[model samples]
Target: MSAWLRRLRPGRRTWLRLGRDAAILLVVYAAVSLWQTRHLASGSAPALAAHAIDGSPVSLDALHGRPVLVMFWGTWCPICRTELSTLQALSRDWAVVTVAMDSGDAAKIRAFMRERHLDFTVIADPQGAMSRRWGVVAVPAGFVIGPAGQIRFRLVGLTSSWGLRARLWLARGGF
Candidate 1:
C-alpha cells in the first residue's frame, strides 16, 4: 500500500469492485439488448389495415411511399406513458401512428388522451388481434419503417426521445 493511503481506513478496493460490477452490469444489459434486436427484420413490415379512434380508416399500405413509426402501447402501461410526449413531438415531423391496445373504447381512450393532452394519431386495438399480428407481446414497442415500407428499427421498453429521433432520422436515409 502507498504511504499516504495507509493513513486512512483501507477499503478503497471495495469501491473499485463496486464500480467494476456496475460496469459489467451495464455491459450485460447492452449485450442482451443487442441480442434481442439482432435478427429483427429490415424487410417489409406487417400489414396494418385498421380504423383510427376517430372512425376513419387507417392503413399502413397507404403509407408505402413514406417513412412511418408504428407504436404499440396501452394507457395503463407506465412505460408507454413515458414515451408519449416524445412520440407526440415526433408526429409533427415524422409519420407516427400508435395502436392503443387494451385501452378501452373510443370514449374512454379519448378521455385518456384528452387528459394527457396527446394529439398523436391512435388506432384502438381493444381485442389485441392487431397487436398479435404485429408480434408485439409487450407495451411501448416501436418499429421504424422506411419509405419503402421496410422495417428499419425496432424499439422495446422505455426508449429515449433522442434514440427514437435518431432512428427516425435513419429511416429517413440520414446517417
Candidate 2:
C-alpha cells in the first residue's frame, strides 16, 4: 500500500464521513418535520373544546374581546413545565389559556396545576381533539391569537424569553 494510503484511517476519508453524517442528519430532520407537519395539518382551531378547571365551559367568546395565549401542554413533559412557568411569569399582562392534553382526567390535570402553582385558566382536553385542532403534536406548543380571532403567532417548541418578549412586543404593535 502507498504510504499516503497507509496513513489514512480505515474510515476517515472526509467526503465519506461527511456524506454519512449528512444522511443521518437529513433522515432525522425529515422525520421530525414530517411529524410536525402532519400534526399541524390534522389540528385546527374551533374543532376542539374543553371545560375550565372549575368545570365551566371555555369558548372563543371568552376571548372575543382580548388577545389570548393558547398553550398546549401535559404533565409528563418537562419542557411543558418549564415553558408553563415562564409563560405564567410573563403572562400577567395578557390573558392566557392553557389546555391540558391529559384526556378526561381532570384530577391529573388539577394535580399538575397545583403542583406547578400555575394560576392561569386551564381547560381539559382529554381526548386530544382540542390538541389536534391546535396542531399540537408536540408538547409545549403555543399560539397567540389576536382579539380578532386570528392566529397572530405560533411557537412550536421550547421558546426563549427573548423570543417570547419579541412576540409580546409585536402583539403590542411596535416596530
Candidate 3:
C-alpha cells in the first residue's frame, strides 16, 4: 500500500506540473498573438512624403479617397524585382507605388522600369527619409493603405499574390 501511494503521488505531481506550465505558456502566447494582430491592424498610415525618380517632391494626397499600395525595395534585390513585376501586372485596378531604397542613380530605376515595361510609378528615396518614416528597416516591405489614410495591411518582406489579395481585401473592408 505505501509503495503504491508513492508511485501515484510522483506521477500525479509530474502531470499536474506539466499541465500548469502548458496552460500558462498557452495563455501568454495567445495574449501576445492578439496584441500583434491588433497592433498591425490599428495604425494610421505613416505619413511619408513621396518623391519622383529625380528626387523631386510628390504627394500621396491624390490617393486620399482611393486604396494605395506602397512597396519599399531596392533595385539590387531580386525579391524586389519579382514583387515589382507582380505589382505591375496587378496595377490596373489598384493604385501602386514602388519606392526604391537607395539603389543609387535614378537612371538605373528608369532603366529597370523601362526594361520591364512597368507602368507603375517608381520613386527614389536616396535619403531614406521616407523609409525611416514608414518603419521600413528592410527591403521589400509593403503596405496597403485604405481610402481614409489608414494602413490596412503590412508585409515585411517578399510576398505573394495571395498575400496581396488578402491585404487588398482587408483594405476594402473585407475580412
Worst 10 residues of 2 by lDDT: 40-49
Best by TM-score: 1
TM-scores, all candidates, are 0.80, 0.69, 0.70
Q: For model 2, how does the per-residue alpha-carbon lDDT over 1-175 read when each residue is reduced to its tens digit? A: 8989976856558778899999999999778756564555322345334578878777766667566677788877788877877778766877778888864588777787788787777888788777876667788887766666666777667887677767756755657
- Cα lDDT of model 3 overall? 0.76
Alpha-carbon local distance difference test for all models: 0.85, 0.72, 0.76
lDDT by residue for model 3 (51-161), tens: 777566656677788778888899888888878778887677778877888887678888877888876777887776777777777778788998888887776666787
Segments of candidate 1 deviating more than 4 angstroms: 1-27, 34-42
Clashing pairs in 1: none
Error of 1 at 137 (Å): 0.7
* 2 versus 3: better TM-score goes to: 3
lDDT of 1 by residue, 1-175 (tens): 8888876754889789989999999999988877665544447898898888888888988888778999999999998988889999999988899999988888889889999998888999898888887777777888999888889888778988788888988888887
